[model samples]
Target chain A: MRVVREIALHVFKESVRDRVPYTLVFFAVLLMATSYLLGQLTAGQEVKIIKDLGLAATSLIGLFIAIFIGIGLVSKEVERRSIYNLLSKPVSRRQVVLGKYLGLVLTLLVNISVMVAALYGVLAYFWFVSDPSVKAGWETPALDPALMVASGLIFVELALITALALVFSTFSSPLLSAALTFGLFIVGHFNADLKRFDQIVASRPVAYLARALYYLLPNLTLFDVKAEVVHGYHVPATAVVSAVGYAAAYIAVLVATSVFIFERRDFK
Target chain B: MPAIRTEALTKDYSTGFWRPRPSRALENLTLEIAPGEIFGFLGPNGAGKTTTLKLLMQLIFPTSGRAEILGRPVGDVGVKRRLGYLPENPYFYDNLTAEELLVYYARVFGHHGSEAARRAGELLDLVGIGGERALQLRKFSKGMLQRIGLAQALLNDPDVVFLDEPMSGLDPLGRRDVRELILRLRERGCTVFFSSHILSDAESLCSRVAILSAGRLIATGTVSELLAFGVGGWELVMTNLAAATVARLGLRIARATEIAEGHYALELPIDAAPDGLLRELTAAGAALVSLNPIRPTLEDVFIKKVGGARERATFHHGAHRDHREKT
Candidate 1:
C-alpha cells in the first residue's frame, strides 16, 4: 500500500509538470468564463444560462483531460522507455497501474475543482451585482450548494472514464486506447436507449443483443443531475447514492482487469 | 549455493504477420555465478547478454526455462529487494531532477523523508554525479545519464547487481571510473554480473566470463583459461641474412618484413619448433635476432568461438540478427 502511494505521488509529480493538463485546465476555465458572457445575453434567464452552460463546460473539459492524459499514463512510459526504470523497482505491476490511475485522478480532481469554483464565482458575481429587481425575482440563489451534487457526479463519472482508459492502455497503443475509451464514453451515456430498443424491437436476436449491451455498457447518464440542479429541482438522496455506488463498482472492475493484464505483460 | 543460476533458460519471440516464425533470443542458457565474484557476460551486439539480464530481472518472461536469484524464482518480488539492475542505454524520467528521481526510487525501497534523501545523495556522490543533483535528467550528458542510472540501480545496496553495458557511452575516464566501481563492489562481496562487448575491460576487470554468440554461450572461463586454451603462433627475427639463404630455410613464414638495416622480422606457427628453425637459420648463415611465443588475447578467443572474424564483423546489431536468424 505504501509502495502504491509512492508510485502515485511520483506519477502525480510527473504529470503536473506536463503542459497538456495545464493547457486543458486553462481552456476549461476560459469556457466557464465565457458562460458568464453568454449569461449576460440571456437577460432575465442569466442565472439559468450560467448554471447550465457552466456545468456542461465543466464536464466536457473534464472528459478531455481524463481521456487524453489517462490514455498516455502507462503508454507514454512504455514508449519513452521509462517503464524499464519504473518496473525494475521492488513494486509490482498492480501497484503501478493503481498508482498511475490514482495520480491522474488527482490531477483531474484539482482541475475540476478550479472549474467548479470559477463557475460558482461567475454565478455569485451576477447574483450580487445584478439589478436589485432582477435579484429579487430570481427563484434560486446564485451560489446554490445543490450544484455540488452535480459536480460530485461529474467527478465520479470522470473517475470511471479514467479507470477505463487505464484498462485499455495496459495492452493497446495510445491511439487505439484513446479511441476505445472515447467510444465507450459515448456509448455509456446512451445505455438506457439500448434497453429501450430491446423492449420495442421486433426480432428476438436483435432484442437479446440490445439487452446484453445495455447491461454490459456503463449507464453514465445516471450520473448527470445537471438538468435537475440547474432548473432548481431537488435531486433525491437515493439517486446520488446509487450513482456513486455504480461508479465505485465499475472503477473497481476496470482497475482489477487492468492489473491482471499488466501483471502478465512482458515489457518486451 | 550459487548467487545466480539458470536451468536451460530460453526465450522465443514470435514475429511476422502472416507467416510468423519464432525468433529465439536466448536458447538453453545454463550458467551460474558464485557469490562474491565479478562475472562478465561478453558478447557482440545481438548476443543474448541483455536478454539474459532481462530474464533475471523479470522484465521479460522466459519461453521455457527457470532462473533463481538469491535462492528464489526470478518473479519473486521479495528477492528483487536485494537485486539491482542497470539496463543498456537506460531511459529515466526526464521531468525529475537527479535528487528527486533517486528519492522516488528510494521510496520504492521503503525509505522516506530525510533517510531517503540521504541515501539518494550518497548514491549520487558514489556515482560521481553528486554535483548534478539539481539538474534534470534531460540536460545530462550520456555519461552522466549512465552514472545516474548506476546510482539508482544501487539504491537498495543490492546483493547482486546486473549491469548491461555499464561501460557503454562513457569516455575513457568514465569507463575507468565504472570499472573501478565494479571492483569496489566485488571487494565488498557484492556479486557483480555485467555484460559488455568491450573485451579488454572484461579481461582486466572480471574474474570469470561467458562469451555469448547468436543467443548462445560459446565460451566460458577465466581470462587465463580462455587465452591458454588455444596455442597461438610465434614471432622470430633475423639480422644480416641474405634473402636467398632465408628462402632456402624453407619455413612457412606468416609474415616477413625488414626491420632495421639488413634485419628482417618473421612470424611463424607454434608447431614450427624454435630449435629446428634456429639450426636451419645457423646452417643458412642467418643471424637469429629474437624468438618469442605469442599469447592469444580475449579478442582472438572471441573471434574463434563466434565462427571467426567474418561473423564478428556483423555481430553488433542483435535485433537485425534476431530476424535473419529466424528465417
Candidate 2:
C-alpha cells in the first residue's frame, strides 16, 4: 500500500507538472465566456442556461481529461521503457495498476472540483444580484445544494471511464486505448436504451444481442442528475450511493484485469 | 552463496502478431557471481546480453530455468528490496527534475519526506549530476540521462546492482567516472553485474567476464584466465636490418614492413623463438632494440570466443580461445 501511494503521488506529480492540467485554464476561460454570453437569455432562463451549461461543460471536460490522461498512465511508461526501473523496485504490478488508476482519478477530481467551484461562483452572482421578478419564476435558486449531488455523480462517471482507459492502456496503444475507452463511454451512455431496443427491433437475433448487451455495458445515465438538479427536483440519496457503489465495483474489476495483463507482459 | 545465480536461464520471444513465431533470445545460460565481484556480461548487439539482464531483473519472464538473487527466488519482494537494476537506454518521466525523480524513487524504497529529499541530493551529487538536479529530464543530454539512471539504480544501497549497457551513452570521462563508481561499489562489498559490448571497459573493470554470442554462453572466466587461454602469436620489432639482410631472410620471415627509415616490424609464429632470430640479426649488423612476448588482448579473445560460439565453439568451463589473429 505504501508503494501504491508513492507511485500514485508520483503520477499525480507528473500530471501536474505536465500540460495535462493546463486544460483547467481553458475551462476557466470557457466559464467566463459562458457567463457573459449565456446571460443574453431571458432572465430566468439565463440562470437555467448557465447551470445547465456549467454542468454540461464540467462533464465534458472531465471526460476529456479522464480519457486523454488515463490512457497514457501505463502505456507511456511501457513505451518509454520507464517501467523497467519502477517494476524493478519492490512494487507489485497490481500496485502500479491501482496507483495509476487513482492518480488519474486524483487529476480528474481536482479538475472537476475547480470547474464545479467556478460554475457555482457564476451561479452565486445570479443568486445575490438577480431581479426579484426573475427569482420568483426560478424553479431553484442559482446556488442550489443539489448541484453538489450532481457534481459528485459526474465525478463518479468520470472515474469509471478513467479506470476503463487505464485497463486499455495496460495492453494497447494510447490512440487505440482512447478510441476504445471513448467508444465504450458512448456505448455505455446508450446501454439503458439497448434494453428497449429489443422491443423496437424486428430480428430475434438482434433483439437477443441487445438484451445481452444491456446487462453487460454500464448504464452510465444512472449517474446523470443534471436535469433534476437544474429544475429543483429531488436527487435520491439511494441513487447517488448506487452510482458510487457501481463505479467502485467496476473499477476494482478493471484494475484487476489490468494487473493480470501487466504481470504477464514482457517489456521487450 | 553466490550473490547472483542463474540455472539454465532461457528466454524465447514470440515474433509476429498473426502467426507468432518463437525466437530464442537466450538459451541455457548458466552463471554465478560471488559476493562483491564485478562481473561483465560481454556480447555484441543482438547477442542476448540485454535479454539475460532483463531476465535477471524480472522485466521479462523466462521460458525455462530460474534465477536467484541473494538466494531468494526472483519474485521475492524482500529479495527485490535488496536489489537494483538499470536497463539499457533508461528513460524517466520527462517532466521530473533530477532531484524529484530521485526523491520519488527513494520514497518508493520507503524513505520518507526529508530523508528522501536528502538521499536524492546525495545521489545526484554522487553521480555528478547535482548541478542539473533542478533541470527536467527531457532537457538533459544523453550522458546526463545515463548518470541519473545510475543514481536511481543505486538509490537503495542494494546488495546487488544490475546495469545493462551502463556505458551506452557515456563520454570517456563519464565512462571513467562510472568505472570508478563500480570500483567503489565493490569496495563497499556490493556485487556489480553489468553488461556491455565495449570490451575495453569490460577488460579494464571486470574481474571476470562472460562472452555471449548468438544467444549462447560462449565462455566465462577471470581476465587473466581468458588471456592465458590462448597466446595468439608473437610480434617482433627491430631496427637497423638492411633490405639486403631482410631479403636474405625473406624466406624465413613471414612479412616485413619498413616502419621507419631502417626499422622493421615482423610477425612470428607462437612456436618461434626470438633467440634464433636475435642471433641472425646480431650477426647481420642489426641491433635488437627490445624483445618481448606478445600476448592476446581481451578483444582478441572476445572475437575468437564470439566466432567460436557461432561456429560450434564448445564451452569448456571458462572464457575461451582459438588463439589470436597474428599481425
Candidate 3:
C-alpha cells in the first residue's frame, strides 16, 4: 500500500508539473468567462446560460485531460524506460496499475473542481449585481445545490474514461491509446440508444449483437443529467446512485485488465 | 547460504507480431554469489548480461528454471526489500529534483517525511550530488543522472545490490567515486553484482566474475584463478643509452622503445635472464631505472574466451554471426 501511495504521489506530481493540464484548465476557465459574457447578452436567462456553458466546459476539459494524460501514464513510462527502475523496487505490477489510475483520477478531480468553482463564481457575480432571483423556468434557485450532483456524475464518468485510457495505455502506444480511448468515449455516450436497437432494426442477428453490445458498452448517458441539473429540475437520487455503481464496476474491470496486461509486459 | 542463486535460468522472448518465434535471450544461466562478494558479470554487448540481470531482478519473467535472493523466490516483495537494482542507462523522472526523486523512491521503500529526506540527503552526498539535490533532473547531464541512479539503488541499505553498467556515462573521477562506493557497500557486507564491459574496473575490484557470450555462460572464476598463467616476460627501463649500444652487446632486446633523449624502454624475452643486462647497462654508461614483469590482463582472458566460444559456436549457430549478436 505504501508503494502504491508513493507511485500515486509521483504520478500526481508529474501531472501537476506538466503544462497540458494547466493549459486545458486555463481554456476551461476562459470558456467560463465566455459563458458569463454570453449570459449578459440575454434577458432573464443569464443563470441557465452560464450553468449550461459552465458544465459543458467542465465535461469537455475533463474528457480531454482523461484521454491525453491518462493515455500516456504507462506508455510514457515504458518509452522513457523509467518503469524499469520503479518495477525493480518492492512493488507489484497490480499496485502500479492501481496507483496510476488513482493518481490520474485525482488530477481530473482537481481540474473539474476548479472548472466547477469558476462556474459558480460567474453565478455568484450575477447574483451579486443583478440580483435576478427569478424562478420562472427554473425548478430550483439560481445557486442550485443539484449542480454538484451533475458535476459529481461528470467526475465519475471521467474516472471511468481515465480507467479506459489506462487500460489501453498498458499495452499500446500513446497515440493509439488516445485514439482508442476517445473513440470509446464517443461510443459510451451513444450505447444507451443501442439498447433499443431491436425496435429500429429488423435484422435479428444485428439486433441481438446490438443488445449484447448495449449490455457490454458503458451507458454513459446514465451520468449526463446536465439537462435536468442545468434547468434546475429535480434529479432523482436513484439515478446518481446507479451511475456511480455502474462506474465502479466498469472501472474495476478495466483496471483488472490493465493489471493483467502490465504484469506480463516486458520493459525491454 | 548464497545471497544470490540461479538454477539453469533461461529466457526466450516471443518475437514477430503475427507469428511468434521463441528467440533465446538468456540460455540456461546458472550462478551463485556468496554474501559480501563483489561479483562482476562480464560480457560483450548483447551477450545477455542485461537479460540475465533483468531476469534476476524480476523485471522480466523467465521462461524456465528458478532463481532466489536471500533464500526467497525472485519477485518476492520481502526479498526485494533487501535488494536494490540500477538498470543500464537508468532513466528517472525528468520533472523531479534529486531530492524529490530520492524521497519519492524512499517512500516506495516505506520511509516517509524526515527519514526519507535524511536518506535522500545521505545518498546525495554519498553519490556526490548533495549540492545539486534541488536541481531538476531534466537539466542534469547523463553522468549526473547515473549518480542519482546509484543513489536511489542504495536508499534501502539493501543486502544485495545489482548494478548494470554502473560506470557508464561518467568521467574517470565519477567512475572512481562509484568504484569506491561499491567498495564501501562490500565493506558493509552488501553483495555487489555488477555487469560491465569495462573489465579493467572488474579486474581491480571483483572477487569473482562470470563471463557470458552468445546468451550463455562461458567462464566463471576468481580473478587469480582465471589469470593462473605466470607473467609473460620482463620490461626493463633504462636511460643514457643509444640503440647502437644494445646492438653491440649481443643482448637480444626483444623490443626496444625510446623513452626520451638517450633513454629507452626495453622488453626482454620470457626466458632471457636480467642479470647480464643490468651488468651490461652499468658498464656501458647506461642507468637501469626499473624492471617489471608484464602480467596478462582480464581483457586478454575475455578476448580469448569470447574468441574461443565464437569458433566453437560457428559450426552450430553459423559462421557469419558474431558470438555476441544482439538479441
| Highest-TM-score candidate | 3
Best by DockQ: 2
Which residue pairs in candidate 2 collide? B220-B319
Q: Is the docking of candidate 1 incorrect, acceptable, medium or high quality?
A: medium
lDDT of candidate 2 at residue B70, scale 0 to 100:
90
Q: What order do you get sorting by DockQ, best first?
A: 2, 3, 1
How would you encode candidate 1's per-residue C-alpha lDDT over B271-312 as one tens digit per residue?
Answer: 778778777777777788888777888888887888753365
DockQ per candidate: 0.63, 0.81, 0.75
TM-score versus the correct structure, for each prediction: 0.88, 0.92, 0.94
Tell me how far the alpha carbon of residue A49 in candidate 3 is from the true structure, in angstroms, after superposition: 1.4
Each model's lDDT comes to 0.86, 0.88, 0.88
Write model 2 residue lDDT over A30-125, tens digit each, in one string. 878877776774657877888888899889988988888889899989999999999888887888888888888888888888889988888888
TM-score for the first chain in candidate 1 comes to 0.94
Question: What 10-residue stretch in candidate 3 chain B is worst by lDDT?
Answer: B318-327
> In candidate 2, what are the lDDT values of residues B1-327, reduced to their tens digit?
999999999899999999999999999999999999999999889999989988888889999999999999886778889988988999999999999999999999999999999998989889998577899999999999999999999999989999999988999999999999999998999999999988988999999999999788888999999999666656677888888888777556567778997798777667777789889888888888766566888999998888877666355422254343332
Better of 1 and 2 by TM-score: 2
TM-score of candidate 2 against the unseen true structure: 0.92
